[model samples]
Target: MPIQLAHAATLPAHADSVFLLPAGTTQLPAQLADLHEASRKYVTEQLAADSKLITVNHYSHRHYFVVASAKGSAHLIAEAMRKSGHQLHALLKADKVTELYVEDLSESADGALALALAEGIYLSAYEFEGYKTDEKSKKPAALTRVLLTGAASAEAIQELDYLLQGVCLARDLINAPLNKLNATQFAERMAEAGDAAGYQTEIFDLPRIEALRMGGLLAVNLGSPEPPTFTIMEWKPENARNSQPYVLVGKGVVFDTGGLSLKPTPGSMDMMKCDMSGGAAVTGVLYALAKNKVPIHVIGLVPATDNRPGGMAYVPGDVLTMYSGLTVEVLNTDAEGRLILADALAFAKKYEPALVVDIATLTGSAARAIGKEGIVGMGTADEVQLLALKQAGNRVHERVVEFPLWDEYAEHIKSDIADINNLGKAEAGAISAGKFLERFTEGTPWIHLDIAGPAYLTAPDSYRGKGGTGTSVRLLYDFLKNQE
Candidate 1:
């Protein structure tokens, strides 16, 4: 929730708490005195006592402005709020401090806004309490409302909403367990979300999949009773005219049991639900854009399926034809994300998008290269688009460290039977995976985000919760907004 404050007359005279100040208002002499005195007391007396300056306001329905100890304090507050099941937006509206400006705080205002917004999302995120036995106690709180104050123009608020929707969508998708959100159910969820967001959505079932000859999707679905689905969501601005569409393709491997190359029992088989993080990321961004009404034409494609080892599961060394009609020699059934994405990437040519960006938790090599931070690899010979992506990455703090697509790496995919092989050697796995995807782009400006590292969380942090990190949503959102 964006913070809001009550009228001055309604606030307590001696509350002595640092009330949030909205952005852009000149402080009155009395208000300034109160803030000054509170800061000093907290710094000197409170620090010495080792006591927190917690504001205990209950009577007022709206939040009152109190200076945060620091910008990071908002995140701390959000963590506490999450545990207590209190919506920060309710307090923000009550406090009337959506846009805060403290002369003493040196943090960048924009960065603070980003942090505050992300923290709010963390606090408002829903957990799957559906199957709990203690029905009464297990009911989760609803953080449905938000209020932003200060010099927030309509456009700024829209942008904020755009980002929030992205985060919330990702959280919902990630929080759902495999039983409830398999490949088919996930496609329905995306379709529903798209419909609600005013985007045109189309889902390709088994018949259409066969018609289109999406062999990778079909191959992956063979082990499961549920058929594969390829979903596409299109968003066109009312005011937009003949602008180049931005195509986003995501790998929706809902549960990857590695097919015939099944993972060990010690490995996290259940967490495979999040294997579709790349698809979720793109879907969330599209939802955000529609919610905020961002004036850009976008098409989001997700090739959804589950890869389980069963009687019909594709085996190693199997050759499958993608939508591009380019045959792939599958050397490792576990290396499936790129196989799905290749079909989507090939289909991207229909839109003739000026830029195509696909995201996937493609390889552990990406995690090794950049750790929990994301590593971005683009394969457009166009230097200008590459530089723009790099700049966009830096500005949004979804910092992308680029890896080269040298000719040497291309040789790894050369196959004796088919045009290309799905799996290369384990060495340089991340680069080879990205290089594998570049083959289908057909020279269109493209970027492949290997977000395996940042997509899931091993621990909780200020900006995100444990489970889904909602990686790459804001970075792409910011890039599209900039394009507008």
Candidate 2:
């Protein structure tokens, strides 16, 4: 269930309190003015010392103070507030405290700090316990109600709420195992999200996909029993800011076994259930934007399937035709993400998109190149557009590291038997993969996001818990919100 968020004119006496204080504080805000003089002094001392990253919880008085220190860059400080928000949720859950009154007195510009903190608090509250049969053992949601009296405006809070809903939706889809969320079910989930979030959903079954001749998607699905689906979700409000739609394509390999080139079970195949995270994020961003009535014409494309070693799996040295009539020689079945995404990117050109962003848990090389700190980005978009995206990533703390998409890199994928090859040279695999996708783009402004490292986690990292971090939804949302 969604948490209840409300606004109060002043401080409420009955609920547990969370106070946001600026760094180097000599005095408490008006709301905290009533704190015992000695306790206030102690809190001020802690803020000045600047050692505690998130908070100074006065357990005795049931007071929790979150610090907004300028110890790092602006983005880092916003992240500190967000992580502190996660800490707030953890603390409340630990004490079984349900109700919270947040007084955001950080006084940062445009209430950015408060909004970031709210994002942390809300996003950290997501939990997926569906498989837990033992009702008592499952960790259910504890923080259900939050009241705010702060610099963060009510409108901003509502937008944050919708955006977080989209993000958690992505997390849920990613966390669901293969048995429950196969290709067909993934399409259904996308349709359901579209229905709820006021977007238009059109799902193409296998026959329709064949009718459209999406050969790359079909070639990848040759090995699996389950049929593939090409899902299109669109949101085009009457007042859309742009003349052309922005297209987002996501790779939706619901599960991957590397097909003919099978992966070892212990590590490689174990986490493949989350292979569809990129699709989930596209669905999420659409949901959030539509719900917020962002007035942007956006179309989301997802090509979903599972790659298994059933009969007739496409093997290396075989050539396949893609949706664009481009022939790609299959060098490695594990390199299937680019194949499926290539088809989606080709399909996107029908819309004459102003910008196209394809996000995927595409390559292990990307994961090894930058282990979970940021996303690997390389695309045909110009410097101004890329800079905007980088800034957006910084604001949301899901940073992007750009790789060179030089013409020289394209030579790695040239094939003897076909127009191109799916697998590139081992070195710079991530960039080469981006270069491969760039072929399908055919010059429409494009950006490729390789979210392999950060999309799923082995350990709980701050608010982004163990499974499916819902990596880039917030970053994409921030980027799109500033598209005008």
Candidate 3:
């Protein structure tokens, strides 16, 4: 359930409490100072005992006095608060406390602190129960309402809420089983979300996709019973910030059975449904920008389908012509994300975008290299745009590690039979995949984000939740929000 947010003139009685405290101090807000003198003493003593204490004090009325260590840069502080929010959610659910009153008593009670706390609490409270048969008995977090004071404006709070909603939407799409969310259905959901968020949406069916001669997409979808879909979502306010739109391309492999190059039963194929996480992240960003009414012209392109080893699936030796009429040698059918994304990147040229960023769970090499800690980014985009994206990633705690997209790596993907090969040598696999997509950019400044490392989490990590982390939504949203 979504948590409701409201501005509280005074802390309401009977609501659970969360206090943000700066490091090395026990000072409380004026409203809470005299009311909880004993609690303050206890917290001070606890802080004295443990220099790294971020403790929670439970008292009567289901109140929790959370003292977080606020002693770092704004980005680091926001990350700490996010983790603290996760802990607070656990405590609230354990004690059956629903309503939370959060007051930032930190020495720095600025908008950044307030927004960080809210983002943490609200994001941590998200629970996806779409297929939980025993959801009622399990009783996920009971946090229903959050009353905030001395932090951000109501408008800012509302924007955060919308952003979280977008993240949750991405999570939901990524977590859904392939049976529930196929290519056509995913495109329909995108249209529905665009409608709700006041954006323009257009979906190209298999026939329409064929009309455009999107051979890469069609080649990848030849195996699945379900048809492929190409979704285009645009958010262009009348007073947009950019003259040309910023284009986002997402690889939407709904499920990857690896075609003829089949993955092992239990190991590689288990989480294939998350293959579309890149597409989900793109939709999430669009939802956030449109819902918040960010004044920017942005376009999202998603090429979606499942890769199965059934009828007429493209073979490893096959040479397929892409949307740009470039031929690609299918060295490995499992290397299909780049094939579809190549077509989308080629198609994005029609828009003449100011900048293009294509995100994909395209390589296991990236995941193995980074180990789910950060996204692997490489591109030929302007240095300024690259720096802004890196800063945005840091701000959202979805950090990016840049790899070189040098011409040297392009040789690895050179094909004897075609323009390029789908798979490269074992070494620097991620860089070679970026090189493959770079061929389709048509000289446009483009960035490739390989999110295989961070998009889908198998275990809970802080407020990122259990399954889908919705990794790039916040990162891209922050980037778009800060665009001049």
Candidate 4:
């Protein structure tokens, strides 16, 4: 989507949709009588009758203003909107209408303006067109432009631009159909995007896997026809030429069929395309960091693969050696994310980063624990880093709640034939999964995000849509910016 700036009067003539701030129920004084009457009778009156409390109808050119009453005292709603086909304006090709908007905005002078710009771009760029055909469209084209009502300073503009870039990259990755976005292809796309965004990149094929003896990755790739790939992205700011890097690892499971263990019919295998959301998330983060020219040294490690029940798929009772030389007994083939991440975590350790953070759509138990509102995380050390992530998440509305990685949980993975097992017993499944990955982190200050719930959404709300939520990108961006 393209971002544009315009004066309030010129906006109505140029935009397919116009957003406005309506006067409050008791706030607008009687002196501005005529203007207040138009706002209250037309806008607030309509909003009060609806439950979603979102859209307010306007007869002129099908424009709508989203409003809410609150303390901050500005009518910017939320900083989000979107355009969809078959809407009133789309039917006439009068340019796409802004489909979503927020009300009750902050009046703070810092990040508020930029956030508003980002909100507009984000709310307007979403589409869910993958499954339907009989109707005009289940999805819509990308939002190509946005018309803003206020002056966004240069710094605010840059911040908003980078935020939108992160969101767009995530939307593109999640919005892709499964057939086009498996492991190898994802790596290729990231490489291309990295090149264009000015980051140094490299990819590891199956041969390199064998050379490096990345047994965990090799074991997971035994099923799919598409080969597995490991991708590395590096960004060193001009000023940080001598500093050690901050590393991030993301689990890149493109499609998970639960391997030989398999999944249930009601499991919704079709949405597995979004299983690589963590990878897409980090990829988006890298794009933003570079595009915004953040003065920091960074490295991103992605271990990519597919888990299918092929003829030679790794099966139950199989023992696999990992890059860390630790052997894992595959008690359940469906428990495959930790196996792949073990190799990637070990690989990241060599860089000796100031910190290592890995994000994965690892466990459904996490969803059960934290629901769809926040990310569930477990860090081996550094309470401060974890707390900082929590604060950042809370501010962005992408929250993270940390769990304990108790050494006692390792008892579940204790195996007679190998060093450990991929998964523990069904109880405490989320924490045990974190324990499994913790083994591979050695002693680094690390945070493991089991983003099973927040990674995908079934409906649109706030600034997020019904598909991939791109859950952690914004929080990660916020945290990184703090170090600077």
Candidate 5:
């Protein structure tokens, strides 16, 4: 469940405490002045040490004190608050503290500090115990609500709440196993989300996909028993800012077993269920925008399928004609994401979008290069758009490192028999994939986000849980909001 947020007229007498202090401060805020001198001294000492501090205050109710230093610029402070929020949640869980009251005394210009704090606390408390038989006994964190006692606007808090909801939804989708979240099921979930979030959704099943001649999706789905689905979602508020919609395309490979070029079971294929994270993030961003009623005309397209080495799976050297009538020579069956994404990118051309961004967990070379620190971005889009995206990434801490989409990279994917090859040479594999997708853009301004590294986490990190990190939803949401 999403953490409930409400403005506190005054800090409750019995609520647990979270104090946001500026860096290098030895004094406590007036609100926390009444804390025991020992606890207060501890907080000050910890602040001086420049470390996260949480301690028990032997107040009337033995309230816990969470002292977090909010130093640096707004982005840095926001990132710090997120980590602090997770730390606060961990302490609360250990102490069984249910109610948290937060006050930002950092005196920073960040009006949304409370929102970031709430995001961290609540997201850190999230648990995916759907398949856990002992869930009832596990008893996760009890943090149910967070009370704010500072200058955060209600609108900003509401917006953050909606975005967190979307992020949580993305996490749930990405964490689900293939048996539960196949292509059709994923589309159905998207349809349900669109309905609930005030967006229009149209799901095209196999026959409709075939009619559209989406050979990339068809070729990828050849191995799986489940059929492919193409899902389109739109949110066009009456007062939208853009004359033409911003289009987003996501790769929805629900579970990538690498098809005919199968992945090693115990090695690379363990977390293939998260291959659809890009699609999940697109859906999450739309959900956030529509739920918040952001006045932006936006559309999302996701081509969904599973790539398994089943009967009639397309093998290397096979030439597949795409939805755009471009033939691709398959060099590696594992390069299926680019193929499906290519179809979606081509399909997006009908919208005549103001700008298009396609995101995918596409290449391990990207993961190797960045090491789960940022996204690998390359595109034919305008520099201004790329800058906006990078700025958004900085704000949300999902930073992007731009790679060149040079003509030389395109040369690496040249096909002897077909228009292009799915896989490029081993060097600069991520850029090669981007170059291949750029061809399908047909000169439309487009950005490609290769999110292979940070989409799914093998271990818990800060506010991001152990499974799906829901990487791009916040980045895209922030970018769209700034566009307005």
Candidate 6:
């Protein structure tokens, strides 16, 4: 069940509560006296100097956890706070608690710590129950309602709520099996999100795609029975901050089967359902932006299809002309994401964008390099823009390690038959993929994010869950929200 969070005016006399305070805190606020004196005794007497978080019981159904706050940079503080929140979630889930109250008793960071805790709790509650028959019934009820006090004001709560909704939406889209959410349905779902969030969605089907000569997207979809879809989502308000829109191009390969090339790779093709996570992130970001009415012109392009090895699949030797009129030699059919994203990135040029960011689960080399710790970010964009994105990444805990788009790496994609080759040498596979996509940008400032490492996790990560991390939604949201 989806969790609901509201700003509470005051703490109840006795209830399950989570109190966030500084490491050396010992005294409770005067207002908290009504809640209970045990809260004070627990912190002053029971809690050890090294204790990070400890629980105290006042009475039945009245559980309280005192979490010691961390110090340092915003990133460190947010992470520490979020980890505490994740612990609280696990505790509540194990205890089968229906709801809990969270408050930032820490007078240090204004409302920052509170929001981080809330983020952790909400994200930890995500579960992919799409195909479960009676699994939800088998488990006891988890967190259903979360009430916040202290620095978490109404505006802060609402904004965080919208931001988290976007994250969960991306997760839901990523977790859905290909059978339920194919290319057509993916576009439709994005359109649905737009309709609900005040953005505009324009989808182009096969005929329109062919008419527009998006051969890259069409070639990737040849194997599947379903046709391709080019989805355009735009959020432009009257109080827009810029004339040139910020364009987001997301690779929307719903499921990848390595095409005619088939298996034999480091990353599991079993997790192919997450191939569209990049597009899902775009949808999530736009949904949050429009819902919050951020004054910025943004356009999202998603070229969606499933890469299969079925009837009439494009072969490795085929040379396809992309939307930019540049030919790409398919050295490896598994490199279909770049082919699709190339069209979208080229499509983005029509907007005369201030910036173009294409996010994708494009290469396994990224995962092999970082191993789910972070995203591999590389682009031709200037240092100022890239630094801003990196700062945003740090704040959201989606660390981006910027790789280089060195001219030397460009040679790996050079094709004798076409303008470029899809696959590069075994080394620097991720950089080569970025280099390949750069050709279609036509000199517009562009950033490429390879989300292969962190998009879907094989094991449960704290607050991020096991699958579909919704990795870059918050990074993009944080960056764009401050763009003005």
Colliding pairs, model 3: none
lDDT of 1 at 449: 88
Question: Over 4 Å off in model 6, which ranges?
Answer: 26-42, 135-138, 264-267
Model 2 misplaced stretches (Cα beyond 4 Å): 41-61
Greater-lDDT candidate between 2 and 5: 2
Error of 6 at 294 (Å): 1.0
All models: lDDT?
Answer: 0.69, 0.88, 0.86, 0.71, 0.87, 0.88
RMSD of 2: 1.9
- Give the TM-score of each candidate: 0.81, 0.96, 0.96, 0.83, 0.96, 0.96
Candidate 2 pairs with clashing backbones: none
Local accuracy of candidate 5 as per-residue lDDT tens digits, 1-484: 5677666757767667676666556666787767768877887776566555656655444444444444577788788878878877887887777778877666656446666777889889888756766756766558788877777766767778889889989999999999999999999999999999999999999999999999999999998899999999999999999998999998999999998888998979999999999999999999999999999999999999999998889999999999999999999999999999999999999999988999899999999999888999988888889999999999998999999987778789989999999998989999999999999997699999999999999988889879998889999999987885
Task: Evaluate residue 114 in candidate 3 and report its C-alpha lDDT on the 0 to 100 scale.
Answer: 54
Q: Give the per-residue lDDT of model 1 (tens digit) for 114-142.
A: 24443443334434344667757753333
lDDT of 4 at 224: 86
lDDT computed for candidate 4 = 0.71
Give lDDT tens digits, candidate 2, residues 106-217: 8887678877777788878878756767768867448887777867678877888888888999999999999999999999999999899899999999999998888789
Instruction: Name the candidate, 3 or 6, with the larger lDDT value.
Output: 6
Pairs with backbone N, CA or C atoms under 3 Å apart (clashes), candidate 5: none
Q: Show model 3 residue runs off by greater than 4 Å.
A: 27-30, 36-40, 51-60, 68-72, 134-141
Q: Give the Cα error of residue 66 in candidate 6, in Å.
A: 3.4
- Cα-based lDDT at residue 250, candidate 1: 87
Residue 268 in model 1: lDDT: 58
